[model samples]
Target: MASFRKRGCTCEKKKCTCGAKWEYRIKYVDRQTGKTKEKSKGGFTSKKEAQLAAAEEELKINQFGFAENGNEVVLNYFSEWLEVFKKPNVKPITYSVQERNVRLNILPRWGKYRLKDITRTEYQKWINELRDHYSEGTVRRIHSIFSSAIHDAVHEFHIIRENPIQKIKIPKDVENTNRVQYFSKEQLEKFLNSLKTPQKNAKYKHSIQYYVLFSLMARTGIRIGEALALTWDDFNEKEKSISITKTLVYPLNSTPYISTPKSLKSVRIVKLDEQTVKLLKKHKINQNEVILRYKNYKASKDNVMFHQHDGRWLRTNVVREYFKEVCKRTDLPVLSPHALRHSHAVHLLEAGANIKYVSERLGHASTKVTADTYLHITEKIENEALELYSQYIKF
Candidate 1:
């Protein structure tokens, strides 16, 4: 219950004749102490405003058993919510992206605003501004993080009654056809061949490791993190398969660590080709020789299959940069290391491999995902199948 009173009123009976501000004193039983406690706020221009503010407070108390700080800054509340609810449950790399979005996108726009005071119109305008600046995918990710946090505020914390960012329009992104997302079969061959070619200015002495590393990705369609997390123990020599159960979490702002794969499907066994198995075996021999030459050197704690000379996990950036260099030297289109995974998938699909098998090999959640990602390839395959049927009917 709340009582409204006029402040600094010289003549106060039922209504004040003097122009005075209004205040409300709300009394509620604190659930923790089982005792009556009072909360009061002042400086409202009218009695109605004071009563409405008190009613909002009462609603929060009734819903959540306590009144949250209605004046809490948006950034401060979001930071706390992210730390308390999000960080522990998500992967380090995923948490980093959310943290970055809060800092770069959300905080700068609404940090200083009171958490309960943000209006829907203003939020929609801000979203529109963001859509103009960022790609649709990026804008969606940003919006998702912000909207998720706000949803918790409404339903979980009862900090706000409604989400301001709900149903905001996002502009569709134009596909950049000129940008190369993956390598052609010939380009992949050239890139892999160049990985084995020696360079005078190369920082890493063993170029064979690069060849084996990239070859594995191009053949297996595993993520770069999954490839980096491999250990000798993961390989089955007789079966010629590699088990993928974990991935490397390489965060730009923190130390790298090993974590579980992206999903349950990602924890699978990928069969290796005869040539790939031979390449890995030969690389193992070379690695063993290097270890034998330096008896005093210590092996990496994780015993990862790929590492630097000092037995540290190879930085992801180093691999990406070197991959670009290899592409340039081969006169191929410069693509990220992840392009190898895409190349592998494209080659498998183009070679008449089953979509389900490709999905499983790529560790996708479903064949639908694989089909959607390579929709153009599926269309091409459809056309080719029809052409083959037409040729057969000519007899």
Candidate 2:
């Protein structure tokens, strides 16, 4: 319904109304493909401004033409397109992660370019450059963003004829660079003993709680975030089980947020051994004492199992720092909080726990992942089969 009409503009510098006038118009058209396109033209006081406005109008026309009627698309328009198209469809944690990757890695490189203009060769070159600078995992994640955005552009928006990154190959799986760590029984005892060292300083009396957190992680194999998201209600003293239904995640530049488990299987109930149950009972008593001592202050409803002395949820990074400190104090190898989960799995497998039980305990989607990840522990099973074969053979 846009009508094209020209309007005159007077210029003070020219001192002539007719000679210095500029024309402005708006036009709408239906393309042969049945797509509606709108174009606008505007005059400015200066010729430079007029040219800039004309170029802007031309870009708008191109953007409109790329999509069908009532459709709009702009690739790598990070703020606009991501908010309108991607954010609503994904979980908060996923949306936050995508936003971070787009802002930090993808957008800085590709934001200015249109989807149709980015060729596979150019994307390949960009990925190669990233490979030289970033880790393989980081490069792969960035490529995922590009692929997802371009795929949406092609299929949903009809903005591009094809996805240029459709055939681009990602690198083969690289061995995880992260060090594999498992606690020796002796080392774990030594670390726990170190945590029991009484703090002479009255300000830091919750050191034992730190030990409790470590022990829980080492015994339960729950993710640090999942542990942090636990509340009093999630635990069942009578049933002797802990329900893992939510996880706490902090994306870059975002506040800590609660998200559902990574998969349906991740929502699980893990039985607590008597020792772990006793530890939890003691932890509850300790938490109550701390709450009484700090009754003057308010606390959040989340009331995480572990908290700062001030009663705030313990930040994940802060926990990592404390872990490092504990290792240093105990003269142990540096280990991440997640290493405790791995240690738990390895120890359980070494104790002759079956693969199915291990998988269920770890809340894995299937037993295959548990078996694959812990293939080292299955060596005994293999040896048993070999021994059976040897018994049948008489040479």
Candidate 3:
């Protein structure tokens, strides 16, 4: 005989069916694909209610299938997307940078999570955790990679409704600015003076390269990569100009690679001062002497501007370490290779160089960036204004 139980069940455990437990299960053929799918609803007060819930879910699945939830697209899918999307569309160097961010940062965090389920709150929490573990700049770069990946998911996979990162604010820290520690003029002079003395440390012979590199950077405002990429051919001794068409870049765990300049503006020819040209000629002669001493070594015109004793290209990391040692010996502030670039801009502005000319020399996309960044050098503006006022005033 069929029995009807009226008393409701409060049992939450799956196996417990002590009371009038109502469980319903359904199997239906997808209307569009004619595929069999099974789903279940349980612990309802009544069978009819469970049936209704199951029907609604079945309808959603039948209409949208996996698209209804981003769970269907896995981490492997996003990885594939990143590779294909970046290879054809972005420059190799840019793609390499993105690849490192994805592998080292993004994948470890949200790779297993579904795109649709990645909410702003979840991202914010993850970002905060990352901030605690890593530097702000690193976390910011990871955020950019995740944001770009999610954006591509929307456009390519149609899996995400919108990018979750668009609404969330990035973490900020003091190091976000272009400002870097720099040697004072007197300290710089002292450091250069110290370089003239032979060091007790044989490894410190390379210290001279730091002086030349830093001095060039301080005078030219060129990026570290651009400085490393300079070649004998790029320098015109007769014309006193430097053609900046390429830059050196080393991606994480990869060998150094050369790439085009940062932008069209970065490809301009910069005129060198007389003193700068003289220094460059001296450096060139020194470099040529070293190459001649090691004639058996492979040295080609296409090689890097700077090289090690083995005739290998000098790694940026090695340069940075040498810079640190020099700073310590000279009792100067510890400044990064980038600080020289900042000093260059500041000194040029202080010497009454116009923002437009500075922008061109620095290869900035616009003068606005140059003006905004070097606004601290107001002495130039004051001197210019005073000169104009003197011409107009009548006593």
Candidate 4:
């Protein structure tokens, strides 16, 4: 609560302009610290002006924890939000995305507005304007970052009652969002064959590294980062299971680092078949032979399964470019490295594999994610399961 008080002079050295001196004084408990404090400001022309100022002061203190009279600007608060909330707690890659999104998208649109001034109607209009300029996915990402920051501003800073963004509907064009494509068995084989076949002016006699990398992606439906992160130690030849605990994150122009896999579900032991084990064993033997051919080139102790010529960890971009060249050589469908993973999922589902087991094998956080991704295969698999179940139920 706040009150208007008359700032009467002491009648000593200062002039006795008691009638002209009125001050707004607020005595309130700090919401965060739970401590009592008093704030006062003098030089108001009259008691009525002081009273109005005192009321505004009281409202600010009670609601948004405003100590003085200024509103927080969006850019200033977002920077503070990152330093206080995002930077300290989030993963490096996660922070990188947050920082980049804010700098590129959110800052341009909403940064100039004060927190209190950006209303739901104007923000909604801004979002609708984005659909024509940006894809649904990009717009959704921009909104997600903005909404998350506003969430913090309310909870941590007490800047607003609720996130106004929560009331807005996200523009989700389902057809645009789900563009993941996969290849058939024949197409995949043709793509793989193109890799092993010798190309003009290539330094290596055969594409052993490219073949192994693509095979790994096909066999295990793991993300490229997870596959690249594999070490010799991760594969248990005896058990035929590989431990997937880490992922290689090679951000553009930044030093590569290892991070915990995409999610808790991704940190799993994925079983490998005997044929794959044999292929891997062959690749390792060939890799070592290549290393020995170089002058004084002892095989690197890094133990990374897929490596560069010097046995260092391979960058993802190098692998992507290599894959692109291999695709150009073949008549098979031109697909990204990630298409190998999608192909694995689609093939398993088409072959009457259980959705639950497939979900676990693919390291999906939930079966719903697997079902959602491979929606085309759901009914066919379910029908196959029903027929198989009928044979067992002898009633």
lDDT string for model 3 (1-395, tens) is 11223346567786556657455555666332456655555666766666666666656554334432354343654566666666678888888878777877777877777677788888899898888888777888878878877776676555567777786665676564644455566776776677667687564342345557667777788988898888788889999988899888876578888888998899988888888888887877766665665555445456556667666667888778877787888788877777777777777776677779989999999998787776546545877789889999956
Q: Would you list the clashing residue pairs of candidate 4?
A: none
Candidate 4, 243-359: lDDT as tens digits:
899999988788889999888999998998888888888888878877766554446567988877766688899888877777777865566888898999999888877889899
Off by over 4 Å in 1: 1-71, 177-180, 292-298, 390-395
Candidate 2: regions farther than 4 A off = 1-78, 172-187, 198-202, 292-303, 379-395
lDDT of each: 0.84, 0.72, 0.71, 0.79
Best by lDDT: 1
TM-score of 4: 0.78
Tens-digit lDDT track for model 2 on 1-395? 32332355355563556644344443545333354445445555555566566666555544533433323323324465578777889898778778888888887777666555678898888888887778777888888876887676677555566777877865543665433466776777787678777556635574357878888888889989888888878889999989999988866566777889878999999898999889888988877776666654334466677776666677888889888888887899888888788788888887878889989988889999887776765766678768989999968
Per-residue CA lDDT of model 1 for 35-110, tens digit only, reads 7879899999998899899999888666545335455567667777788789989887898999999999999989
RMSD of each: 8.3, 11.3, 11.5, 8.1
TM-scores for every candidate against the unseen true structure: 0.80, 0.74, 0.74, 0.78
For model 4, the stretches where C-alpha displacement exceeds 4 angstroms are 1-70, 174-179, 294-298, 383-395
Candidate 1 global lDDT: 0.84
Q: What pairs collide in candidate 2?
A: none
Please give the TM-score that candidate 3 achieves against the real structure.
0.74
Winner by lDDT between candidate 4 and candidate 3: 4
